[model samples]
Target: MRRIEKNSLGAALMMALLCSCSGRTTSEPFVQSVSLTRPIALNRETSHLYSGIVKAAHEVSLGFKTAGQIARIHVSEGDYVQQGQLLAELDDADYQLAVDALQIQYDQLKDEVERTKQLFNQKSVSANDFEKASAGLRQLGVQLQANRNKLDYTKLYAPTNGYIQTVNFSPAEMVDAGTALFTLLDVSRLEVEVSIPANEYLRRDQFTGFTCRAAGLKNGVQLRLGSITPKADGNQLYHLTLAFAGQPDRRLTAGMNVEVGITVADTTRTGGFGVPPGAVFLDGEVPCVWVFGADSTIERRPVALREMDNEGRVVVIDGLTGGERIVRAGVSALEEGEKVRVVETPSQTNAGGLL
Candidate 1:
């Protein structure tokens, strides 16, 4: 009976100790491990890329000043031409005949004027008769010049160095005066055209720099502000024209599509902080982030967002200042004012935090 009592008491003490240990384990506070990072200083310069198109600075329409039948076309569409090169010619038979007729009359009147001038000097003719002869000679000379100009107008010449975009008339085709016979695309300079929204148009003066990228141009090209429309179009978008800083590559041509990047100074975004996108969460409708405090506890803080950067980081314009430690990863499972343990970043020599 004594031995049985002693064994039963020992077993009861063991059970009490086991129950105490389990209770202590259950009552311990839970602390979540999380990665933390300090907010980065936001850059005051912001860059945005937009779609643009290459266009020739000057597009000209070639036409004849006088109406006539097309005698021949010296060049075809897509041909490159230099300044003063003859592009086409009209049938000059009728124009030549008119000039010839005027020249004959002009010559005859000139000889008559000289004879009258000598006779007047010799006191054989009246001053009025000499003046009349001289006047007739001058009138005939003016007529001759007018016909010569018409003969010259029958031929069309390139006004500038350009590429022929269109040839509307062919040989033996009759065309009216001032009708566009050819479309010339002046390739001496190029311009890039892009449409921007109203917000950007309002801050057009804040633009700092511009660049463009096109097919076959790996290094890209720099551009300068050429002009911007003062008023918005029907779509409420403003048109911006950009010119090349230097001579552009020869491969770039009119109507080709390109990508334009514009950089602007963000004066309104002063005192902003850049944080990882994963660190930002939503508190109801408002954007919130988990800010780890000095006491090793995280609280949900609302932040006013500006815009995302090129590296996919969220820019917080208000609420959180720089040098604040925020949870960088695994923020969804966290609760308000929850105690947390910061996991140290691994060293370069000891990756994966194994060491």
Candidate 2:
């Protein structure tokens, strides 16, 4: 019986040894694949594009100088007008009649003054009577001149050559003095207005080289830096005025939208890499980036994010050297030293371009 028990124990030990050998020989590390991109050197020329609108260099809202009932409107919205062109007419009957009455009164006074001066020369009139006649003529002359001005005010004329953007009132409508009657735009020159974030206000020196391209145009227009608002707007942005480097096309008018591209360089900064904002994920409140190694494996690398551009991309200031391949997405649920495969897709790159 003791001999049988010994044999069974030996058989059990041999089976256990065989199982261990098979396990050791068949086990191999599994490989996992993921999408990856190379870290772009932050020193490379970077571009920031902003959407802007084309504006007239000079715009004016024309207002009526005097209040009256509109009798006629000679120009329509979008009409081109020259300097001193009559744009509208108010009722001038009252003013014209006043001028005629003033003319009659001035003529009578002049006759009386002439008669009084002759009598004074003949020593047949008193000095006071002659003086009274002379003063009456002078007062009538001034009154007549004032009436003439009132008649002229009945007509609204263009102060400058421009295109009428809009006419606010119709014929027969009563308008008040100093009320806007038309909106005129001087399209002789054009400008682009772009609002940039308050934080990214470019110094006047930085704008020496900037380009703007309007929609439906083939080439870019050189920008002559205009003015930067000293104050922030309601949206916490600053307004930048830029004019075309050369003569702007007449077709490009106010209110048209355009894209302004500004290329900037920062030599003061160094040792940085550019990556998509989404590519970075927080690992326990610390910013981290998953770097892919040449061995088809990924390792979690902590990154020091420096500054973020207006384009939503974060600048990695530390923990990453340029040219290291990194996982662009799906970094939230990844392990250290995880094997990953790099896949190329058309949209995969476009997705990253948003940054």
Candidate 3:
């Protein structure tokens, strides 16, 4: 009987140790301590990022002035060309023969006219015959000039310095006069194209100097504002173009994408606030925040954000006015009307505060 009593005592101590190890907590209500800070006003000026495309300053298509078979093409697509450089040529066999025949006829007419003039001096030929021959010669001369111009039209030359963008005709293909046989892009200057909303477009005049950074560039380059379209596009956006202020980056080619930034100052927006990202939480799609009431209680307040500022803080545009205390953290656990205390340090010790 004494041994059984000792075993029961050992069992009781084991139960007590197990209960202590379980780490049970009291089912009691608690208050959470949170740090409070109010939002401040924003700057009068703001900057925005927009998608832009790099474009050639000028693009042109070149073709022959007269129609014929393309006999030779000296430049291909992507070839660099200089002003007055010969790009392509047409078969001049027919044009040459026409010129030769016309020249011979003109010469013959001239000889006849000369002989007629001599005869007229001697009274051997009538005045009517001499005048008719002279008229024929003069008409043939005009025809000769017209054929010569057509012959010169056989060769195509570049009007300006640029790179060939496209070649539309082959050496053996027949094309009409004025057909676009080659496309050239002027790369001496580069421009960036961006679209902006109408409201921003109205204030484009107030935009300060612009800057742009392309995909492969280590730094951004200053850009000069070119022109803003007076008319709006179908999407209600105005297209604006900015030219490179200095020599553009060599790696930046046409059709390349870039991020363009423009700063605008709006005096009407003199008052706003910046809040930490953690202080705001998404209530579905809308952002909401917990504000510490004057009575030390917490209430959820919906807020509107303008944009992310340079310091990584959200610019609160419309929401609570200035001088409203907000909980810095522990927002997810707090409920509406829950009494809380403002703590100097943001820490995890706010889990069990004054009840």
Query: Across residues 193-269, which tens digit of lDDT does each residue of candidate 2 receive?
Result: 98888656854344436687776789887787788898998899988898888888766778988889876665434
TM-score of each: 0.74, 0.60, 0.60
lDDT of 2: 0.82
Model 3: per-residue Cα lDDT over 1-355, one tens digit each: 9999999999999999877766453434576778877786777778888999999989988999999999999998899999999999999999999999999999988988999999999999999999898988999999999999999999999998889999998899998999999999988778999999998898877798788888779899889999989999999999999999999888998999999999887554545788888899887898888988778888889987776765677777878888888887768888889998777753465645542
Which 10-residue window in model 1 sums to the lowest lDDT? 266-275
Backbone clashes under 3 angstroms, per model: 0, 6, 2
TM-score, cand. 1: 0.74
lDDT ranking, best first: 1, 3, 2
On residues 271-353, what C-alpha lDDT tens digit does candidate 1 reach at each position? 58889999998878899999999999999999999777656788898988787899998989999989999998788998887
Error (Å) of candidate 1 at residue 272 is 6.5
